[model samples]
Target: MKKSTKMMFFTMMIIGTMITMSSNSWMSMWMGLEVNMMSFIPLIYKMKNNKSAESSMIYFLTQSMSSMLMLFSISMNSMMENKMMILLTISLMIKMGAAPFQMWFTEMMNKMSWMNCLILMTWQKMAPMFICQMSQEKFLMSSALSTMVGAIGGLNQTSTRKIMAFSSINHMGWMMMCTTFNNNLWIMYLLIYSTLMMPLAWMFNEKMIMHSSQMMTNMKSMTEKMNITCMMMSMGGMPPMLGFLPKWMAINSMMESNMYMIMIMMIMMSIITLFYYMRITMSTMMIYEVQKKWMMINQNKNMYTSIMLTMNLLLMTMMMFF
Candidate 1:
């Protein structure tokens, strides 16, 4: 694609998200989602390979079906408000790829470029999830199901992208739970989730890492390995890391709301997710028998990694003080 074309599509995505965020009416929100889908489809299609084309087609079909359902529900809500609300909720759930609706999400992650995966996992979630928050619907069953599916689905995956996709679903569950009690907490969770995800995505793109098996073979130095391990652990929301803060806050809020059963289920599922993360971390640290390859580390990349690690540590300490 041409530079100008890419720029245009990127701008459209941003504008579309802004429209969704600012829109008070369901009609405008739905329109914004359509704009986002249209802009993003081109970005997903690649001339070099048919995989991107296939992924884009799947994405388009899914979004179109969801949009149709949403439109129908909106039109019919006057006749049966409660039933229409449930239909509308399901439509948004499908759009966001919350569990049971998540098969397309994992497939797309496997086929997409790292940049596209990042957008799918993070930016693409904002509109639908925000809509879910605004709807104030009871999504307890969906939230729990998504959490369990994300945790269990990722346990056997070797693909790094698929693992992250499941992780995103798990976080979506947490975000959904947050929406039940407070919108402000949902915003905070999203912010922290995106912040922690950006560095990991950047690392994956920089290294061209696609699988968990490659970590032990590809990483050069102990420092690099350690940084990646810590980052992954942090992303898993391990205690004493910056990632833990949001989950901690979320659990606290849930407890205050007398949501004990759901809170317990979420914590258990999170532990399962963290177990896989630990497996990845241990693989990086323990299996270091590959022929040593002296790959020159880029200074800027090193600086960025250092800054991120330092900030995480600093924040962890600051939280401890409070």
Candidate 2:
């Protein structure tokens, strides 16, 4: 965990993702993915912790299996068999941790540092997802299953990281759907997803919050509570929020394609996800006190936190004028 070592791995991550994004050949793409996987495993290891070690090992096994399958599928592409293409799609799905292939994802999140979790949730997905996009295979069934599984899986979880992991899986479904239809929409969804997630991740890291209950107990001021509530609500894709914009566009696209059933299912599952966010928000609101002692004691006024929260909360309103 030396500073130099971290930088080296970080550089590898950037290079790997760039290579995958730019590569025209499947072999080069697979090489970039291997580089990404190898670089990330070291970053997952925390000092003197068996859990991180175990998590990293599991991650390596899963990713390596998927990489091999990808290579095999590529090798067999000349046969023009449907089964080979299906295997390729499944390999990318596993690499991206889409649901049904998502068993490793939450466990890995639980053991990783918040920084590593951020990278896992966001940057690590880029290469495989881009591969998925390019494959152009029909995976609507997988997309629906991912969204449904993500929604139901998080409903009973108290752990914040696990919930976010499920949320990521759910978003992956939407991303897959968009990628299947329009590349531009997929990119827009990703940008917005990352934008909403950054503030939430930063807040959790700053407060060391690991559960929904912690938010209710740890926040001291009305402002902190409100900010947290607003942020979570927006992230849940409530109407008039920045997060809703992408979903709105997605629904419109789905409708145009006559995908009514899939559209309905996605909307319903999203409502279930929002219900949990509201539950957490309500818990915090009900416990908030107006007493002087509760007035902004040791408020986190970190510049980055303030800026991200402000942008997340107000960006939708700003967009209204244009």
Separately for all candidates shown, the number of backbone clashes (residues 3 or more apart, or on different chains) is: 0, 0
Model 2: lDDT of residue 50: 95
Q: How many Å off is the CA of 221 in candidate 2?
A: 1.6
Give the worst 10-residue stretch by lDDT in candidate 2.
294-303
Off by over 4 Å in 1: 289-301, 317-322
How many angstroms is residue 285 displaced in model 2 relative to the true structure, after the best TM-score fit? 1.5
lDDT of 2: 0.84
Instruction: Score candidate 2 by TM-score against the native.
Output: 0.94
Q: lDDT tens digits, residues 229-271, model 2? A: 7778877889777788888878988998999999999999988
Total clashing pairs in model 2: 0
Residue 300 accuracy (lDDT) in model 1:
54
Q: Write the per-residue lDDT of candidate 1 for residues 177-240, one digit (tens) a residue.
A: 8888846888888887887888788878877899998888767666667778877887788978
Q: How displaced is residue 19 in candidate 2, in Å? A: 0.5
Could you give me the TM-score of model 1 versus the true structure? 0.95
* Top candidate, metric lDDT: 1
